[model samples]
Target: MVLCELKQQLDELLALSDGYAYCNQEVGRLACVQGQQEAELTALHTSIEAQNQKLLASTLARVQKEGAIRKGLEQHQQKLVAQDGQAEVLKQQLAASNLARESLSTTVTTALKKLALATSTQAQRVDSVEERLASLVERQRECEVQPPPGWATYLERNAVSLVALAVAVFTLGLNLLG
Candidate 1:
């Protein structure tokens, strides 16, 4: 019964280990995805800032030109509108990414919690199994030192007598057959 329980506990521990491994893998994957999204967002922000700087420089240059000033103003307005649209799109993407990141974070936290619980349970089971095994080993050692009831007496008395009786019976049978 103890051995069966130990085997069951071992199986449970193996299953928990597998679950922990899977959770860790999922956490890594989510982290990678989050990092990639953050990098992309940073790149987009940098590009937008660079574009704004260029627009400001171009506007200043056009302000000094007499005939090109009005045309430049119109073009600048159009560029600003396009930039606004791009900013809105970026805002939407950022919001979406933020939501996704939050969701992934929650999932990772839950998985980590489950993994921790499973690990703790497995440790407790191992300790229990170890204790039981130790006790059984001690009992086995004690049994080896202590013989069972009448074992030595039975062996000593019966051994020689049984051998002599067998020898006599064999001799008698052989003489009769001859």
Candidate 2:
């Protein structure tokens, strides 16, 4: 009976050892799973950080580009403003020049009218003087052709007076022409 009891006790010990071995195997497998999960979590964090860096860099670059565009637009606007001012000045200058030209043209027209009137008056005066001179010459010729009985002595005495009269008429005509 003692031998049978000892055999039964040995069988119980073997069973307990088998259970402990199984528990240890399960613990080792669970540790391996935990390590794999940690590695996956670390890789996921690294990927997220890389994406965030790319996004930040792109955002910065975009902001710089927008700022440059805004600055260029401002400069262009300034240039347009300056050009507008210059155009206004040019418009004013053009208006002044037109007014001056009109005034000058009016002056020239008035001067031309006065000159034409003076020329017409002068021409009439010259014609009247020429007609008077021609009549005097005709009278002198008629008197010379038919002298009366005392005409010879009278002509000799009045010859100097007649010559003076002719010279005066010629001088008067020249003065009028000038």
Candidate 3:
């Protein structure tokens, strides 16, 4: 009975040792799995950071391009505004030119009317003077044989003065026409 008791205790001690060794092997396997998980997590973090940097760069480029486009649009708007101002000024100038042209045309028309009236008056005067000259010539021929009457001599002198006056009027009319 004593030998059997010793054999049983030895068997129990051997079984406990085997259980402890299995527990240690399980702990080592779990630690290896934890290490693999940590490496994968670190790789994922690095990938996320790289993607974030690329996204940030793309956003910055987009913002810069948008700003440039906005600035160009503003400049174009300013130019359009300036051109509108110039167009307004040109319109005003055109209106002023039209007014001036109308005024000048009215003045020219009035002057032409006065000139026509004056020309008609001058032509009538010239025709009356020519008739008087023809009558004076007929009277001079009729009195040629009657000779030295005092009235006849005075009438010849008056006829010479009238001829000079008619020549002066003709020269003035020519000057006005030219």
**Candidate 1 least-lDDT 10 residues:** 62-71
Highest TM-score against the true fold, candidate: 3
Pitting candidate 2 against candidate 3, the one with the higher TM-score is 3
Q: Counting only residues 3 or more apart in sequence or on different chains, how many pairs clash (N, Cα, C under 3 Å) in candidate 2?
A: 0
Q: Estimate each model's TM-score.
A: 0.38, 0.39, 0.41
Query: Which residue ranges in model 1 land beyond 4 Å of their true spot?
Result: 1-82, 151-178
Instruction: Give the lDDT ranking, best first.
Output: 2, 3, 1
Candidate 2 segments exceeding 4 Å error: 1-11, 80-178
Residue 178 in candidate 3 has what lDDT? 92
State how far residue 78 of model 1 sits from its true place (Å): 16
Write one digit per residue (lDDT tens) for candidate 2, span 1-178: 4346445655655565575566556555655655665576567557656755665575567557556655655565566567875555555545665565566556556755755675576566556655655665565555446433244544475577657767878999999999
In candidate 2, which residue pairs get closer than 3 Å at backbone N, Cα or C atoms, i.e. clash?
A: none
Sliding window of 10 residues with minimal summed lDDT for model 2: 146-155
lDDT of 3 by residue, 1-178 (tens): 4347546655665665576566556555655655665576567557656755665575567557556655655565566667875555555545665565567556556755755675576566556655655664565454444433244554464566556667878999999999
lDDT values of the candidates? 0.58, 0.59, 0.59
